[model samples]
Target: MRIFALETDINKIKQKFCHSGESILLSTPYHTFSFFFSSIRELFITIALFVVGIIAFIYDLPMGWTLGVLLFIWVVFVFFNLLKAYVDWLYDFIIVTDHQVILVDQTSIYKHEIRPIHVDNIGAITTSTQFWNIFPFGILKIHLKEGLGGDTVMLKYVPHAEEVAATITRAVSSHQSRSQTSAQRRELSGIDDSE
Candidate 1:
């Protein structure tokens, strides 16, 4: 049993999808505030559970079925919410690997969507933020192959989104340069072959 659930989950994903020599450059989840604010209802429920536990302890409730039930309720509430948050934080990520950019969305345990866009296919990158348009956190938007009508990938409430966007942009540029060189060489060879 892995002591840290998040690391364990991430390891599983990496093991399953990462290709040979495709090292992970970066893996980022949404900002912490995003996790808490995304589900306000869950926050309230967690708080209420704490209150109930406190009340039971203060009242010196009988150590019988009632106490067990109370503890059980607390455990379940904490477990479910933690699980949900963990899943959200785990699957909802902006991952940059050597070969491509990966966007993962796991809305539920059984349902997940993984989109991998080659670095050469990325067309644009943008960032939206606060604190003079550059602060605590921001949104990272990645546009893929604009001429091909590729859709955008959004990583909301990402801390240091500006930096992440820059990294992706650099990778895209590097990939494009290599691709263009390869194309030019092929064209030159084709002309020679025709002769």
Candidate 2:
């Protein structure tokens, strides 16, 4: 999506919002912070069942009881999917802006928050993953300077993470250069007033 304009002093930004180019990108770190457990929920359940199954086998439970345990596990798997969906809907974030990066987040249906990441303060764009995620669904982490305060907003599970990171990196660099030049000009003019 193309950046159209950004007004940092007013805390406003605008970006292209065509459905085709629109993307929901979350910081891998943020995504993992919120729903990282969802990825391993099934694994933990499976392991617990394996341990229980071994104990049940030792006790020689009736075939009916064994079937019941297996059914319970199946139900748990279905419930896990529901939980994952809810997490996805709850904390999803989209970075939308034509000139600067604005983090648009929905904390809840009734509450929403948007934070702008100064393009100049965006330090680096990168991605990282945990040991387990590498094999199946790899995670992407974008690192940035804490200019506007707080941690970097990660883009998690992004399919084309490298490409997105590159775009952000370039944009941030350009923003910084422009900011440096502006600062120099303002200092030379000795104008500290904001209007």
Candidate 3:
């Protein structure tokens, strides 16, 4: 069920962002551990509230009914919070196409930021994992060429970060080589643009 939903989302994004002849090389979300850590606070609070509510009811404490109602409302709020976190995680993804790399940072239902970096503008790709490689998670950073923002785009908690970085590096290399070949052909054909 979730896989279907994810496919649907990816399809929508491709339709909206991808250009003609652009093919997706890779699409992935942050690691599962990141999602768990992001929502840990809410999970703990929900559990604590449930336990307290149960204890109140069992002890026949004063205002027990009111306490139950309040706890129920709180639980509903927490549930919605968790749901929002899940939605954010589900919608956020990194997509690498033959032409560019797209990062969809979905913060809420109404807000999302899409950053697209052209393959030709990619200067470097790097990945770093935690000490001792405790988990199958790491960060991937793509350093853009100067003047095109001149900043690094970082993706955190990426699963199999090394593989992802390598894929992007290959795409960048291929694009650059193709561009150079076209330029050389133009030069050999005596194509003059300085008119």
What are the candidates' C-alpha RMSDs? 4.4, 9.7, 4.0
Tens digits of per-residue lDDT for model 1, 1-195: 233333336566766677987878788877776666656766677688668767877888765755677668756866677667767765577788867887766655656677777887788999987446544788888877767688787777787988888888877777778789999999999999999
Best of the two (1, 3) by TM-score = 3
For candidate 3, the per-residue lDDT at 183 reads 88
The CA root-mean-square deviation of candidate 1, after full C-alpha superposition on the true structure, stands at 4.4
Clashing pairs in 1: none
List runs of model 3 lying over 4 Å from the truth: 1-8, 62-77, 191-195
Which lDDT tens digits does candidate 2 get at residues 1-195? Answer: 111221222223233222344343333213343454554666577677777777788899885788687768756784556455444544554453323555555433344456666555666666655455553333445456665464656655553455556666766666678779998998877765542
Write down the TM-score of every candidate. 0.69, 0.44, 0.83
Best by TM-score: 3
Whole-model lDDT per candidate: 0.74, 0.53, 0.80
Taking the tens digit of each residue's C-alpha lDDT, what string does model 3 give over 1-195?
224224326677777789989888999887877778778988888777778777877787776575867677776877677866886677788888988998887766656677888898899999999545799979899999897877988888888899889889988988989999998988977756643
Ranking by TM-score: 3, 1, 2
Relative to the unseen true structure, what is the C-alpha lDDT of residue 67 in candidate 1, on a scale of 0 to 100?
A: 60
- Residue 1 CA displacement from its true place in model 2, Å: 22
> Cα RMSD for candidate 3?
4.0
* Best model per lDDT: 3
